[model samples]
Target: MIRRIFPYPVLSVGFFATWLLFNQSVTPGQLILATFFGVTSPWLLVRLDAPPFRMRRPLMILRVLWTFAKDIAQSNLRVAKTIIASPHPPPSGFVRIVLEMRSPYGLAALACIVTGAPGTAWISYDPVDNVVVLHILDLMAEDDWAASIKTRYEKPLMEIFE
Candidate 1:
């Protein structure tokens, strides 16, 4: 009986907590709505046949967060210098990176990390090829970008989510 109601317990709690946070209230009506969504969304989502999420090494999340913060800070300064201080337009191009990690959650995290940094955008990911395409403002550093992404980002994410 409990299983039928809370199909995904963690997801249910997340949905509930997120709703309450967005509303910033614990009033009766708000609680009702939060409860309704908390129970229903995950119940309906079970149809998607998504892979189960299992974090093998939860402590690695701190490393990923630290790396993301540092990269964002450095990228911001570099992009600003190129745009505001340079005389010439910085070279920009797309580069393809072969990815070994297949977890959807890890891929999503990777997308956030790449796109969150200044002067770089996620172009696309091809599942069949297991490759990710990224457009970077500094094309001359394409090789460095590819290697940095693999080691600085993907490696940590793979350990965290896969």
Candidate 2:
């Protein structure tokens, strides 16, 4: 009974708090609405046909997150330097990278990592060939960019999600 009532207890509490915070009221009506939102939201979520996901190596998350943070900082500095100091416009081009991991969750995470970087963006992904085109602001070498994405993001995402 408890499990059915609260599929995700923490998420329910978060929704409850967020509703109250946004409304800025503890009146009886607001409280009832907030409570309804908190409970029904999870029930609706459960009804969605969302794909199942299981983390294969849950502990690897910390390492991947650290890498993402460090790289974001470094990429921001590199992009800033190019913008502020470079005499000529930095070379920019798109590189196609072949992805091996097929899990939707892993692919989505990879997309986020690539698009989140300051000087790089995810242009398009071809599902037929499992290839993703990434636009890089500082295009030194296509092979280097592809290799970096494979090493820094794709591999870890595959390990965790696939």
Number of the predicted model whose lDDT against the real structure is largest: 1
For candidate 2, give the lDDT of residue 85: 97
lDDT of 1 by residue, 24-114 (tens): 9999999999999999999788888988879999999999999999989999999999989999998899999999999999999999989
Model 1 scores a C-alpha lDDT of 0.92
Clashing residue pairs, backbone N/CA/C < 3 A, model 2: none
Instruction: Give one digit per residue, the lDDT tens place, for model 2 in 1-162.
Output: 877899878889999999999999999999999999999888877887668978999889888889999999999999999999999999999999999989888998888888898999999999999999999999999999889889988898899998
Model 1 misplaced stretches (Cα beyond 4 Å): 25-28
Weakest ten-residue segment in model 2 by summed lDDT: 44-53
Give the winner by TM-score.
1
Residue 52, candidate 1: how far off, in angstroms? 2.8
Error of 2 at 20 (Å): 3.9
